[model samples]
Target chain A: MKNRKIRGAYTQYKDNQVTPEDSYWNRRDFIKNLGLSGLAAGSMSSSALMATIDRPVNSGFNTAEPLSTENVVTHYNNFYEFSTSKRKPAEMAVNFKPGNDWKVEISGEIEKPGNYTLEDILSWTRVEERIYRLRCVEAWSMVVPWQGFQLSQLINLVKPTSKAKFVAFETLESRSVFPGQKRGVLGFHVLPWPYREGLRMDEAMNPLAFLATGVYGKPLPGQNGAPLRLVVPWKYGFKSIKSIVKIRFVEQQPYNTWRKSGPREYGFYANVNPKVDHPRWSQATERRITDDSFFGTKRIDTKMFNGYGEQVASLYSGMDLARDF
Target chain B: MSYLVYAAIFRLLGADPQEEMLHQLGLWTLILLLSGLSLTPLNRIFSIPKLIQYRRMLGLYAFFYLVLHILVFFWFYLDANLAELFDEVIKRPYVTLGMLATLLMLPLVLTSTRAMQRKLGKRWKKLHQLVYLIAILGCIHFIWQSKSDLNEPLIYFIWLVSLFSIRAYFARKKAQ
Candidate 1:
């Protein structure tokens, strides 16, 4: 019984509680007093259980800097399926239902290709918190703490064949949910749906590549790509496709939505390179969106590979970044 | 007049006020300038000579909003950095086109006074004709600056083309 109790404590620790001794003891006392009925009530629903989960485990990937406030992180988004405006997604997505029965279809050049529900996917991998700097192609950026597992973990389960050279992702297509998909004479035909993005096989397996399902210690808001989304930190934010439903491992480089929409402006690789400027705007500096003062946002010189050069620079050793960009 | 109310509504909503303000100002500038250009054609078509009286005020208001647009851009985007603004004007093609359009309006604005218009005589008509070119440049500036969503700019472009076609038809008739 004593050994079982010790193992239970270890399992609890691994579940994301990384508090120091004092807080841990205090929490233990609180749980002890709450008794069996309170614990049962908390675990009755997945969301309620998630609520008890601590706000982002210190996965050691977080930057030394403080995370952006959850309010700003949740409110500001670039989910163009709802609307092109940054604020529109937050507003319109309130009506969007990501539904509890979400499933991801994984196929192409994989041994274990099948449709896996969100619960099955979650059960297969270990989720952890990773704070990454998200840099948009439009010269704006934010630091967000994402809760998810590494893309490689999911990739490993599928067991890619030698023929699988690229990994393509596709977002959900529902005109009923995504009002932006509707055709109108006055509406802008900027992007073709459903949104698509791809990564070279090696890039997909990179340590930094993540499949996020939650943020701020809760299930992701619909606007922020609930259920599943790709998070490729080294690339421009557009490359990180959101609300993904399909993952395909293919032989050739797949067509990315942004690249298809604006070939001259958005390149296929979409790496965060400062040297290459968009036709309409310069990319040398980025406005840190979190730093909003009365004067304006703080502009900082954009870092090559978005300050992840140490980990990602070697990936493009032989290629010219400017040309690829 | 309604533009002010629209701006007030935007401000109250607590949206990205800077971006909305700049967009609205630039849009009104184009609208007013185009409206000013339409005045002579309207006067000719409807035989209402007094309609031309509002032309100068409309043109001046267009220039007013343009100046505000530039000021907002400078204040928000560049943090009023004159050096960086100069660099943008030099390096960016869209900025160059926009600035050129604004600069071309300067001479017209100066000569818009009754005293100067009377002093220049026939040259005044020829000089004020720059408004047509300015309108074209403004459309190009807007279209060029658009990243993707060219619907609005395309509408403006079609408007300018139709307006020019009407003026051209009248010009040919006058020559005949």
Candidate 2:
């Protein structure tokens, strides 16, 4: 509770400064729009946790114009320790330490593979704001204005080899930083630090896959994979691994966290395809987070690669998605 | 507790509270199923007699949630759009798996009563074994639902596998 103000400090990120008061009203409007009065109820009932849960769902976009250069660099997540619920990460990450001593290792099929500090990566590229629609595999979607650039441009500096068929990413695997790693929720062996994910060579090189440094148009927040993260727009949300510390361009496929746990369920290219339902639920429809409740809003049909067909559908054109999926 | 939680959710987020209520029911149902499945393992580890008593409630809750989950999907999500629902069930693997899991849970719930248990006698045990099958089906339902977001459901799968593995190893040991 002492550090609650830490979240309120609305320093400028790309000139998009949302005052604490404005954010508070925004949250109120969001809840009212969602038909949720839980914040007021929680306030009356003396439940701070529920009040927190009722926080304005960060669509991550600065709706007002001039494309505020003061974009908040970090997008706080709701990943909770109690469960791997979509919103849990953001809620539970409030107490996390924002360490400055972060160092990332870049290796594998690259010409120059070595350790690089967070500052090194940021110095390479100027952050740019782009509004993106994040469609979670759970059939929920949110539009966010993110700050970063094509990771390939940076990776190109390393000069990946011709044999570098796949580019795998990894995140720091620390219980102190990520409490979820400590629990035996899944049978993942902590052989190395930073949980891993990979993309096909071209996919990794694609302009759409951003090497994000900040979100909401500013420097990345500690809770939202501050310092750096990956944002693969066409894939499922998880593929955009956060809090990254390692980048390996390999000829062979990388041992991805989710895929290693269940290969039958999670494919390497976790693209958002309504046609390819996740054996347990249909992905044909997704709940848009911004829809006003007064209209009795319903799920809209999901498109292939989440409407990035023009840019990404060709990636899997020759391959049998059903079989590969 | 989850039932009360669902009621409270309905009271709070009034945007088709049934969907949210049903979502909670489905989640808790899976949790209880995993808990129920863990009974044998817990019994094996601690030799506790009381754990088995809760299995019935847990299994019934799983069934309860499954029914509610399906009803909400059909009524609210589907919205009496029978053709669309039918098309989805036929075309979508996830929807099909969900339906399959729900349909399989129906028989188990119907025969869950003390009268049915007494009437079936030896056959009741055979009938109840269907829970293991239901659990597997439920897991498939979740796995498919996850797409590739396997973090949560993988935990359930791991727990379910461990529980069933313990039961299997013990059964083999007992036979030997």
Clash totals for all candidate models? 0, 32
Worst 10 residues of 1 chain B by lDDT: B7-16
- On TM-score, the leading prediction is 1
- Weakest 10 consecutive residues, lDDT, candidate 1 chain A? A1-10
Candidate 2 docking: what grade? incorrect
Q: List the candidates' TM-scores in order.
A: 0.82, 0.63
Encode model 1's per-residue lDDT on A1-325: one tens digit a residue.
Answer: 1221222111212445233334434544554455544654754443233235443223324553334456557777788788776778888988665643578999999999999867667767877877788898988777787878899999999999999999999999988888877664567665789999999998898888999877766667888887689998888999989898999999999999988888888998889988888877888888676522222346678988888887777788999877788
lDDT of 2 by residue, A212-315 (tens): 76665445666667667788878888688887788888888777766776676668888988888765557788755542232233567887887777777777
Q: Per-residue lDDT of B1-176 in model 1, one digit per residue for the tens?
A: 46554645544322344555677789899999999988888887888999899999999999999999999888877768899899899988989999999999999999999999999999999999899999999999899887666777888888899888888989999999
Superposition TM-score, candidate 1 onto the true structure = 0.82
Worst 10 residues of 2 chain A by lDDT: A64-73
